[model samples]
Target chain A: MTTMKDIAKVLGLNESTVSRALNNHPYVRPETREKVMEAARRMNYRPNTLARSLATSRSYVVGLVISNIANLFFAEVTKGIEEVADAHGYSVILCDTGRNPAKELKYLDLLARRQVDGIIFMSGRLPAHVVAAIKQQSCPVVTISRDGTRHGIPTVRINNRAEAAKATRYLINLGHRRIGFISGQLDDAESGLPRLEGYRAALEESGIEFDPAIVQEGDFRMESGMRACARIMQAAPRPTAIFAANDEMAIGAMKTLSQLGFKVPADVAVIGFDDTAFATVVTPPLTTIAQPLRMLGTSAMEMLLKLMAGQRLAEIETVLECQLVVRASCGGTGL
Target chain B: MTTMKDIAKVLGLNESTVSRALNNHPYVRPETREKVMEAARRMNYRPNTLARSLATSRSYVVGLVISNIANLFFAEVTKGIEEVADAHGYSVILCDTGRNPAKELKYLDLLARRQVDGIIFMSGRLPAHVVAAIKQQSCPVVTISRDGTRHGIPTVRINNRAEAAKATRYLINLGHRRIGFISGQLDDAESGLPRLEGYRAALEESGIEFDPAIVQEGDFRMESGMRACARIMQAAPRPTAIFAANDEMAIGAMKTLSQLGFKVPADVAVIGFDDTAFATVVTPPLTTIAQPLRMLGTSAMEMLLKLMAGQRLAEIETVLECQLVVRASCGGTGL
Candidate 1:
């Protein structure tokens, strides 16, 4: 391993000069810095990251806590985060809790132990006590797609209630009065409650009577969505339109509808949220609310970076707007 | 901050006993350990990870080097890795290179400096010199979905050649004599060569003459697949079937085929590799070779753990089999 001393000796400069140049300290002369860099590159001198981290208390690494990576929506968000993290010379350590609170706690402990510079919590809702513990540890945390204001933590999220309402209102405008909703698991702490509220709010505004019988819960899985759609199909005066909380469920509902000889946007119109990659690939395409997944990810990372730098954020809750993409499923021209 | 001495004094036990109890060391008496744990819990004694790591020279964290997390196939593999790592009380530090070799090298250095117990390289075709450098660092490394034979490193992957050949043979059995191939980026060090070889081998065995004009290159992306399909369609006497290296490309090809008024299976049979989540959701569903994604992830982590333990593994390469999942696109029952 080549050290700073070796580079200094090779460049006929003091070790401190070489160190300053490597750190890009402004005091180092440009010409001398170039010579030092050339010598360091030639020697393949790699800095001692551990020693530097101990001295500076910055790991140049961020921790990302996610519920599951298999979900396309989260996957897209992760990509966005990765792009920004890389641009800032920060590596991301991902912890997937499988939506288990206990597992989430375990990962929190692990990240704390590693002394990561900052953390971005996505999808899974952390327990209040755990959040308190994280704050006590003095770790910078930015939550995404989950409310963090009560905990005094910064957050990035899409307006789930408004997006859901927009999708519902779109269906209502399409001359469909009897609309049904397929929700993610009601137990889901972050998304379930707000999305269902949005659906109800839209119905109330449209002067349409809300029917509890028309609502079904899914586990935010395609198979669960399929089963949930089956339950909705069995209800009397079946809805002429259905809105799924996310695209996966919407695709599943479409499959069930197609099997039952229902033509999308002809016999029924369907709308989904999150507009995952499959939303455009599915038959008849899908009219869905786009969540700006990549932007959500990148913004969360940037916010966490700011928090780590001891900077006051402009907003505690950064609410990104959602766009409704109309496609054939909602009786719109194909993209 | 409650130290071992404080806990020991409170529990009327030696500091070593308290440490052993907290670490769940087998030598501690069961009843005494239980008492110590109860006291420690009451005291809110959180173990100092940095101190523990310095004492043990092991942090219980593994490094995961992946080319990209946005790809569904890699995401599934990551989920599998996470399951095993979490179960074993290990956390994964993810390093995504986005297929950039320079970024991969930077991550390897960072992980080494962080003193990760081991590393799992997934889909990152690291250069020989870089792999050699990692080996010299004496950290255990296990490669997934790529061969690490040159560097004498442990690897876990599916038999790509055989799987591709099987997919092509299936198409031939479906009475498609003129088959087209959509190869993933030829520049990729992994998958490209083996898959192309498999395609050629299948054609030779079926006594069908291979046509260079029928093969198109894709970047394993949906848009790339669509473009490649369009080029293949423009070829004289278009192929009756197309085999894509992965599901995303296959779906893209299907989209283009549908737009051209070609009915899947009846007009052009399509097969894809890697049965991702969206494989079944697409309109003609995809027939794909299913890699044991979860198993691959789990095995890589296990191998890395063993390596970290200084165990000598005789077989460096672990090859898992791939299954052909027939779906509507290939004239089979939909999944």
Candidate 2:
């Protein structure tokens, strides 16, 4: 390890003086600071990277753009990203967009201004202009759980279609033919459309007709989920089980069900995606499709690192698998 | 709104070349980079703060040291801080300590290295060495929710004693005399001690003697709360109500109560602190002591900003109030 002490000794300066110079303290003469910077660079001191990055163009920092910081899903994902990032001598700046597209764009620009080496956008709405801006800067960007609409940008996400189909099949095998679906916004290309496709595919294969009447489009929020639950339950033929697109919506639906005097699994079985921490805590617990959220984050950060290193990509998109965690909300495995 | 183009015109250089010089590209002669830095300083361009900081020592970045970013409490608090920080032209790097004391120390050092203008540390177990290190740096740090054990540093937090007493008394007024208390780790100074005193004070005021058997030590986590509930329920004379130190523990206790064939309010009324989102979503909807969590963050950030701006403080500490949210879990007030 080439420490600052080595640089200081070589320049016949005190350690504090070398540190002050390297730190760009205003009190240090500009020429002295430049001399310390040059000597530190020659000594290959890692701490001098503050000045070294000027020549190397590496900040050794990455920005993680998350849709909602309050969501447990993002927290677990961040833990995974930090685990990998720490091992590589990088620190993460978590930029929470709070699910606002405009805020997302603003945070992206802010990160760019800060000169983060790369950015990993985790599960959020990305406007076209934001993509274009990212392209204009030629930034190293990777989209996680949400695909980047920008052509050829790498993405790390789960097989939403396959997973949704599997979750629906589990409900069907549990003797639920009248299954309702709580979907994300229809316009959400990454999760909504594909998840709906999988649900329909499973129903079609099971000889159960897909009924739009039982499908309620939720804005992927709790209140929306609660409203959708009420709508689906009042249909001409009520659903035996409800499959929610995400955990928040599912939890919300369950809350509404309980409020309406319906017992989970007995009166209305429910399942959700994401398998957030709340899934296990909610009454009866939730049986749902579990995305490998942590892995998704790690994979995205790894991809972004590769991009930052200018490594030739073998896979532009990496799709991981999802799991079906059985709990009391689905009324057990005995069909 | 100074632009690099203006600086380019002044120096008679190409736009990209001027950008390169300003960004300290090694290709540019050191003298040219210095000239561009000097010009950027003269023009007062905002983004040029990267180089400007070398002269003025202002990174315009604040670091938030949180115990657990995964918790909803921290998320809401961070939003408050960000709102204030953005208004002051500062960006925050949310450092999630993740409840690991060593990681907290590491992140503190990392923020120091990053040259953050100030830091706001939220509740967590702060090791003595870490506090000592923070004191040594002479950094502008304002403890939020957490208090500064290091002398004379500013702190902004809630009246834990007052709030906890109010929550306990609410349960008492609901005609519950044998109330169980779930407390945080005794050694954890920020939340544990003050909260316990309030609970005891409330019990004493009602002439209900405190029983050691009815009190359980929890680590302000859900698992501990669940276990504490079990232990409290198994007592010779089980309590009619339970007051948890934090929301996580309260929710955990409720889950356990349900599993043990007990009904909230009907069998065992429960109250919690922090009023997190879970307080509403949980079965029966927990009645809780609602801290002004957002204001706590904003207030601390504001104090930190004042400290960073070299402003004199009339009051070194600010204590906010808490509210009691009545919900289904506590039953009706007339009980």
Candidate 3:
């Protein structure tokens, strides 16, 4: 139970002086600070961070609301956030909501009640209630993957519509006329709906008719993708290529295609978004839309830090670019 | 801004009575508690959890020390930990060390100083300094994937050695000689070294001579596995089969095989440890030893909870089982 008082007594210094020295206050002499630190270490003094935080209103902790950590896309983003948080001497309280709005909101209120200095909202979609709560809370918030620009909240996200269109155009360029699309929650305004629109736009530009029967809904899960494949396989004039909203579904579609006696790129082709770790591991190294996830996480965290420091954001919606990674899955040469 | 006192004054009751009702104390009538909750919600009262925690010397927070969250195995384990912690109304402070010893130790010290109710050590290996720190800290520590039996620490882990031997024997039973083994750090007593021993044991039991040249090191990463695959290919006698320590490495090796113009199962049959998500995504889906990662995480958290509740562990080491998932990579029917 050694305390600042004990260090002060050991060094024959005033209690206030010891506290100032330990806190690295400018008023304390450097020599006095070193002496106090040495004494504190020798005594094995553990500071009461709770009390210190109460006094300074700085907990050195932040909240990170992530959609799903099991997904490699979010997992890599979390890694990036952690790297930055750790470097800044801050700990993160990760709340994985599994895409449940209720769970996400519950965590939001809980984090605010726990007095986190700031929060990083890393969910894919921004619901109205959550935006309202964020606006009401005194703490700063930075959104990742969703545009929170209209609400005056800073956001870091990639151009989903543009990237999705690029992916579709790439498939069209590869001589894919009858292409099927596996979408993730077509109702999702931020990502799914936009991606579907991109596919339709590409088809329109290529003078190819968009067939609703060939498009299936997948929840961005492998099983859903497999199920979607079944639907697409039964459609008239079966598609020669399939584009999934994400890599998991694409991999799942590949698995189903193989099970149904179809060889990838030989009989059919496939493409995926979010070039996650699974992209490279899959048989043909999937062609995908690569978003700089680590950068996304890093930038979001940095934005929150700046906001927490009482600085106004310079950018409202920080949009990052996505790259089209050509791989064997899309009949691209390994070379 | 609404306090219990305000509710008490408005209801013509004592503040203590209102507080007891809101807390759902046993002495408070159910009707009164319900009324108080309604009033609190109507008034939008937010509880000051910080003050209550300070008074009770409890933060309702636990520390989860994980090696790497980007690894799907760890991510699933984290999901399990979060599920259990949330059920108990506790938040997890995730400290992903990325297998860095210094970072791990720093987080350990930080968690201790932050006064986390308990800690779950989820690293592949527990260093001596960490063990020493765990012993010295007041907070209870539960370890996952390591044998903490000797140090009086409760542990939840699968039988790595037995599982490894089983996988090796399965390969041997398939009439494979000149088998290659890709391992994590051989010096890692917790997982790598034991798995290596298991491989040797299986080889000796099968009357197959153990050759050092066939074994290579992989740091549980895809790139490391790829590099090891290259080295194994250059061995005096190339291996007919390979067993990578984990699925990421196995997938990497598979990619290397394909790039080198070798087909899996046809040229070199392969198996992997930890049937991660990548196992099923890969072409010729990998056959692997599936560790109950979520159960391991759940059990570890439960063990720490018991220890925190002043209960002594009846068993120090809680060993879980591993299952053999046969897939296309090992030339096994999808059955």
Candidate 4:
């Protein structure tokens, strides 16, 4: 690592003179500054950002705590966050929790110790201890999940309940009376419960009975979706339509349906949420609720940047819209 | 944000004494250390790792420069890296380049400025300037891509040529004589060209004539795959099977084949590489070569750790095995 001292030695100047020249301080002559810059560039001397951050009180790094790395949806969000952060001259510390509480807390503590400028919490639910940890940090924290705004933290997300209701209503309009629902972790008030409530509300509006037996719980994973589909299939008279909270589970349900010799949209229709890349690649091309995944990430990062700059947030929660992406899986024309 | 001075004030002790006690200096009494620890905890004071790193010369951070974040294959690799890094008490700085040369260079400089302890370069091909940048860095760098080892940098990856040959052989054994090949970025010596060479080698070994007309170049993206597949299909008599450099392309090829009214494994069998999650979820599934994506990440990180610890690597390049995962897409039984 080339340092100011190394440049000074090469130029036969005082280290402080080299530092002033590099920082473009008025005390240093322009010719000397030019000479110092040339030498620094030739020696590949990178400014020590970590040490400089101590004086500036700005690390220019944001910690993104994602719940799972395997879930492809987060990948899009991460992309959006990286683009915004990079344009702002910020680097991201990716802390994948993989839904482990211990790992999540450890990463939060690590970020605190490292003194990151801010954090973007992108997880399903915010635990109390995690909230406490965020509160303890003097740095601003913005969340790209559903529940964070409840704690008064700036949040960026879509209205899961309304989007889910739209999906259910779309299915209802397609003339499906009995619809099986695959709910995410039911305890996740920000994610699962609200979506479930939306499904129920849509059913009530359509004058269709909401049957608990036809609804199965999934962990928002493919395997859980497969298992839930199997369970839902066992319900007497089997629902003609299924709406999964997310695309992964919906694909899992479709896989199970395929194995059972059922044709999608003919024997059983399927709908999914979060129109991730998988939605388009699936056999029938899944009809899903397309949440502004990348926008959510960019919006959260922008809000965090504002908060970090000590600016007041015009809106505490930025709720992006979700659109129904109609495809073959739901027996609908592309929409 | 609590500082040692705050803890000292709370405990009615000198700040220097509190610092020494917190550091557990041998000169400090055990009782005084305990009192300082309790006070620090009560005040929620976190020892600034940035300042501590300046003294220790260890950032406890590793920079992972990925070419693309949207590629699901890298997600598994990141998960593996994160798990190992977390266990080693190191944080990961995720630098996504999005395949832009300027962005890649910028991130490399950022990692250098931040003084990351080491770096894991994950990209298709290592450009000459990137190699130069790595060489100039004081910290160790291990690449998880193909060509980094050519510059004598430690690398961890599957032998692209050999793995592609295996995929080609699998298809050959299934009685496909006219096999169309969809290559990745052809200039990527570490990724694209080697895989293309492998396909040629497999054809030669099987005494099957390699026809140039059926081979099309792709950029390793789904759109490229679709375009390449369409081009390849324009060949006279149409190749009976297609082998894509990666799964995304393979899925795209399948999509194109379906649009052309061709039945997979019946009209035109399709195989892919890097059996990603999409391989299984796609209709009819996909038969492809499965690289130990996660293990590659773990291996590169572990090797970088060794290099950072000043240990000599027994092997300059660690080559993992790639297996053929046979499924419905190729009309083949499980391997």
lDDT of 1 by residue, B16-35 (tens): 99998988899999999999
lDDT values, one for every candidate: 0.84, 0.82, 0.87, 0.89
Clashes of each: 0, 0, 0, 0
Candidate 3 docking DockQ: 0.61
Per-residue lDDT for A148 in model 1?
82
lDDT of 2 by residue, B69-94 (tens): 66778877877887788778787876
- The prediction achieving the highest TM-score against the true structure is 4
DockQ of predicted model 4 = 0.74
TM-scores vs. true structure, each candidate: 0.87, 0.87, 0.91, 0.92
Candidate 2 DockQ, CA atoms: 0.33
Model 1: clashing residue pairs? none
Q: B1-335 in candidate 3: lDDT tens per residue?
A: 56778888877788889879977789988887888888888878777666667678898899999988887888989988888888898889989998888888888899988878999988756667878988887889988877677787788888788999999998998889789999988888888888888888999998999988889998888999999998898887789999998888888899899889998999999999998788888888899999887788788889888988899888887899999999989896432
lDDT of 1: 0.84
True-vs-predicted CA distance for residue B127, candidate 1, Å: 4.0
Instruction: Give per-residue CA lDDT, model 4, range A76-166, as digits (tens).
Output: 8998998899889888999998878887788888898899999999864677988888787778999886588889888998888888999
Q: Which docking category, incorrect, acceptable, medium or high, applies to candidate 3?
A: medium
> Which has the higher DockQ value, candidate number 1 or candidate number 4?
4
The residue-level lDDT of candidate 1 at A181 comes to: 90
Lowest summed-lDDT stretch of 10 residues in model 4 chain B? Answer: B326-335
